[model samples]
Target: MMAGLLGNNVITQIGILVHDIDKVSQAYADFFGVPKPEARWTDAADKAQTEYNGEPSEARAKLAFIDMGSLQLELIEPDLHPSTWRNYLDEHGEGPHHIAFFIEGMKEKVTLLETNGFPLQQKGEYTGGRYAYMDTFKELKVLVELLENDK
Candidate 1:
């Protein structure tokens, strides 16, 4: 079911760019009285397919996810190359990077948002899902990520 927000899925996750995901995740876990979330890095092979500013990039970020019931907190540590995470850290320092929402038609949603001035800043795939970060910081004050899974 589509969430009420924007007539689409709800904000299911909050993405943060951090200097050290392991450390930051641990801190968050400790504060919440939970175990540290599992960490995974974007595959080196998959890295080549990632895009930053519409060009191929090798950037990879170590990711950790904590399920807070319906909503999740995502931590990202940009380990290599230049990506949206790296750019956020370099330009704005460690903080909230994006608010993520799961959608049905990933490509179409991305295109729709783009036409409204939120261009795709970066995009990549994981095991069964893909995500695209739209550059909305300038107008919306926060980057928005569109996630989709073939589940």
Candidate 2:
């Protein structure tokens, strides 16, 4: 078999865009018999250093994370901004957006994906790490998110 770009193929998270986080998070909690995860907003642009299509962006979103043992489910309600989340929600309505993989050497991995046909769509920093969204919809049927956490 051919080698994988990420070395490992374990999916860490699945992200879904939503119009209303409160309702959706609660619904998921009810369905799963788990406590509703608290919803919160992403960091400010200054802190997140968010970029879309290579341009700086102030896009933010309300988010909630549901823990499902080995996998995580993320719900996002984007603001009226030009971030990747906003673009995906506007273009595709509320639904699954991306599958995420946690990785190291983010810059190199991002470059590898871009060189291999998957282009970078958006990227940003968070508290303990950073994330990049790859435009892989045409090939993989869903966008891909690369998350690099501080170790």
Candidate 3:
């Protein structure tokens, strides 16, 4: 079999899709003994609507960005309608949804993954970085993200 997406990059963040942002955020804060994350809203999040799996939804996400030493944690809660987060929450219940890996040459990496037969499930850019999600998780069973930090 072809080698899996190759790299030893450090995991920069863990995205947790939660049904109750407050509760979840609080729990993490308590567990880690750190103050709660400062909440932020971004149009970047709204763009995820285009990637939904036709679950008949209106997608809105309020995100809280938390800093845990050098690592970042994102707490996401979807609003009022079903979404990828909502679907993941429904199927798996509020918890770690994805792990992001910091990468170099993101577009080239995406090309490599695609050429290796693992086409992207979604690709998008946000304020601090660009991200590509590969659907190889179906067979590989792990949500893999190749992230290019723009900072």
Root-mean-square deviation of every model: 2.1, 1.4, 4.1
How much lDDT does candidate 2 score?
Answer: 0.95
Over 94-130, each residue of candidate 3 has an lDDT whose tens digit, in order, gives 7777777777788788788889877766555566777
Which should have the higher TM-score, number 1 or number 3? 1
**Candidate 3 clash figure, as a count:** 0
Residue 124, model 2: lDDT of 96
Better of 1 and 2 by TM-score: 2
So what's the TM-score on candidate 3?
0.74
TM-score of each: 0.91, 0.97, 0.74
Candidate 1 local lDDT, 1-151, one digit each (tens): 5553334657899998899888999999999999999899876635437888988888888889999999999998997578898888899989899999888788888888878878899988877888899988997788998888887
Cα deviation in Å at residue 108, candidate 1?
1.2
Sort by lDDT, best first.
Answer: 2, 1, 3
lDDT of 1 at 51: 84
What is the alpha-carbon lDDT for the whole of candidate 1? 0.85
How displaced is residue 145 in candidate 3, in Å? 2.0
What local distance difference test score does each model get?
0.85, 0.95, 0.69
